[model samples]
Target chain A: MYQELLTGLLNGDIRSLARCISLVENEAAGYESILEQLPGNNHTKVVGVTGPPGAGKSTLVNALITSLLEADKSVAIIAVDPSSPFNFGALLGDRIRMGQHFNHPKVFIRSMASRGALGGLSPKIIEVSDLVKAAGFDYLFIETVGVGQSEVEVAGVADTTVVVVVPEAGDEIQTMKAGLMEIADIFVVNKADREQADIFAKNLRLLAHTKHQPGGWEIPVIKSVAIQNTGITDIIHAVDAHHKAVTGQHQRQLILLADRAYQLIQHKRMKDINKQLLMSEIQQLLEQNSFNLYRYINESSCFTQRGKEGKEA
Target chain B: MYQELLTGLLNGDIRSLARCISLVENEAAGYESILEQLPGNNHTKVVGVTGPPGAGKSTLVNALITSLLEADKSVAIIAVDPSSPFNFGALLGDRIRMGQHFNHPKVFIRSMASRGALGGLSPKIIEVSDLVKAAGFDYLFIETVGVGQSEVEVAGVADTTVVVVVPEAGDEIQTMKAGLMEIADIFVVNKADREQADIFAKNLRLLAHTKHQPGGWEIPVIKSVAIQNTGITDIIHAVDAHHKAVTGQHQRQLILLADRAYQLIQHKRMKDINKQLLMSEIQQLLEQNSFNLYRYINESSCFTQRGKEGKEA
Candidate 1:
């Protein structure tokens, strides 16, 4: 069954691709067999669009989709919302914003919410993304909802990362968490028609310019009114420039490749260590004198020694 | 040095408690030693307060503090903001909101951020909460800034979890995420003086009443104007009622106790599996056709084959 799905996926069968993505995302039975057959490095330009919620990220993504369609490029978007676990309302809001792009044959949009998946969100996202790349697209856009460390994880899957912000987000310097500043290859100040937009854009440009970059790429700050269909071309230009700049850096590419695998491996390694077994062991141990939380955890086979050392000691 | 700190902690020394909290929050050297020396289960009523950003959670906490102080109960607050990684802006904001209680002899406030800790946040919080419990406070309040799985993890450490939401949050039925609904023992309609506050409060009451409760405790919904100190007493009453209702449920108590240890153990297990090492190994394997993410992860020593079946396989 999975072989048929994989062949269909590689042949650009849309229904097969959608079914396989859902299976991978949900980690259904036999998902591992499907993942094992996936090819490496499909050479798709994976652009990550992330920003604080209410920063017009979906609108920006919608406009970018239209622009990409105009340039005669096939695009697939993975709208990843980690916040939807808190509220499905935001996910619904996102769909409404991108509603117009649903019918375009050249555009593919999939919305994912981290509801049932607790410790597995990142791995599922990476796997589904790989499947999407295998299905073949000229460009892939992945949009995440928040600006926390989770956003940093999203950057691992993206070749070019664009951090979107609005005019109001500029008032407080503290709002731009350090992790967000470190990963941004391009900055889009969206909602440019709003009050204080000009000042916000200027301040953002200055901040991006002043931010120390150990790499050679100069981060471009683009002013965008995504709702008005303006400044989308500039963002495309910035993305192109970043792509060209980073393509020559072989070391950075390897690091990104490693990062993509890191989360998947870490999650997979942790999955077999059952929480129920650990909790049962802990419950029995709590009544004993040697039942210190730290000691017990440190002495676990994974952390310290295997069975031989444990038995000997 | 830690001995002196531990001695002061047992004797109810304030500065020593602050210093020890910093040490534990930072996971400094000898911190686990300090944790080991502390007594277990000091009978502190730990209440967790959590909500979305800009929901005025800190102000609600401030009002609750005043009520608790008036009751003459000595209190220690662990204001756990899992959002800020930069210079302690949210922590400072929380302190400012609770400024008046800073000098009170019976009140202790400490702020914790997720800075420098990625997967370690929940375990550190659980360990620190245990330390605060050992300090002989009548009550402990743990507050978190964002609505994510991290907040749910924090709820594991609390006796009663209070989720604060404003009037605007009541409009969408989809706004209440599943995990939040499950953990909420009490709900606060904060900022109840706004235009739609009354209707919102009624709607919240309906929503909470409709949710499933396997534990047989009716979740209470209280309205509060935290800035003006209105409806604060009702929240306290709700907490008391929840405590009385759940005290006899032995199974539930054991479940909560196990949850507190679960994260600590999981984190400790993952800590020794270095990402850079795994990534480099994965990079090497990616060149081989047989290299699969899931297969490689499964073959790792931790996940499987550490003990019983390895010799046979």
Candidate 2:
């Protein structure tokens, strides 16, 4: 079934792609089987775009998609919006600005709600991005909800993260102070037609000059009028340049690969142990109104020294 | 040790209170010892105040403290601020605004950094609140980092949550749509001296009238000019009224007690389990490269089953 789903996804069937993504996002019962059968076709260049609200992220994404399509590249976009706490439903309206790209056959746009997930990206976003890649897209863009420190985490998960900013979001340098500067492979000053755009761009460049980035790559500050599609071609070129530079740098690639591998193995073993302990602990808490179930679980687990300490103490 | 710490806290020693709080916030090595010895002396009414930034929350808190102090009541305050993600340090400047109360023996204010905690409240906030209660405070107020949804969670952990808002925050009604209204025991339309305060308050009152609140409690919209200390007495009276109504209503009190018990149990159990699992998983992830660590941990927990299952199939 998993192999069949992967084959269907690679065949460019949107329905198959959607189903697989839903499965991945929902962690549907057979997700592991499907993931196991996924072809290791890492052709897609995943770009993550994130910034504060009103930074014209969606507009910039639309412009980026236009450029990618002009180069005959198939594109997939995942726009994440914060979910409503009461109903756990996402407004998913961040992509409303990108309606023009709706009918474009080569552009597949998916809107996801962050769903109370603290990490700016939804838990299933990585899985769904993989599904999009499996569906034969050349570029996958993941956009995060526009607030908090989680944007850096989103950037870390993607192959490349594009940090978006506008002119009037407080002092231009102060924007860098909030952890956004370090994550950007490419810094975009969106709404560049606005007043202070040049000043903001200069300030960003000066800020970048002071910091020594890993991999010895310079963080380029590109100005763009996303709505008018100005400097978009240059932005695309910069993105391409980053893709090439990072892919060519063996050391960075090795580090990323090692990080990804480490994440995967740790995830698997913990998942196996947690599945057995979590529900029982939750039930015990409900029944007894005590957090001691964890101590009980720790005592039961063969690997925990804390369990031995608990018994001895 | 926990009993000694509690005794120190009750004696109003800042050093002991700080030490107790540090244990709670960090889940420090001796937390279990501290928690185990805590007596059930919850005499302080926990009131949570939250809203969007620039909604005059700190000013409102300032006004509320003055009103409470006028009634000869002792107040303990915890102000949460967003921490710098890079340094994990908080600015801790909000307390500066409430400096008038610094010299007041009856008012104790502490600023807490979110400290990269996922929830708006740090893990040890409840424990700290407990300490404050044991220390003989009449009121304990928790002010959250004013990001909308997360603030609601902070409010939930309190006995009565007062949502503060201003008129110019655009679509005053829409601000409530962010789930602030549901959690609010009382709503304060602060900065009433501003142009649109009356209209905003009326609209909020109308909205409250239309909505069916649990406990059948009317969420009063009190218009206040915190700078002038206007309408503060009424706000405090409203809060006291809320406390009385809840305490008088048997069902409501039971529900609240059950909720608190559940939270206590959940925290205790999860902290234990999380400590054991997090260390091993962090270690394993450091060692391996193939596993999806996030997925493993998220899927391993029963709490995420519905969310995970919804995606995987």
Winner by TM-score: 1
**lDDT tens digits by residue: candidate 2, B175-266:** 33445666778888877998877877887888777666666888898998888989899988898888877764544544444444333433
Give candidate 2's iRMS in Å, 1 decimal: 8.9
DockQ per candidate: 0.17, 0.10
Evaluated against the true structure, the overall lDDT of model 1 is: 0.71
Clashes of 2: 23
Worst 10 residues of 1 chain A by lDDT: A304-313
Highest lDDT scorer: 1
For residues A8-67, could you state the per-residue lDDT of candidate 2 as single tens digits? 887878878988888877767767776665565467888899876667787888888998
- Share of native C-alpha contacts between chains A and B (below 8 angstroms) recovered by candidate 1: 0.19
lDDT by residue (A1-313, candidate 1, tens digit) is 4899999988777788899988887768877777778775465788999866677788899999999999998889998776534445666888887989888887788977632323434567778788888888878899987523456667777889998877763223334334466678998988788787887778767767766654667778888999899999999988877877786465676577666655664455445555666656666665554345655555654332342232211
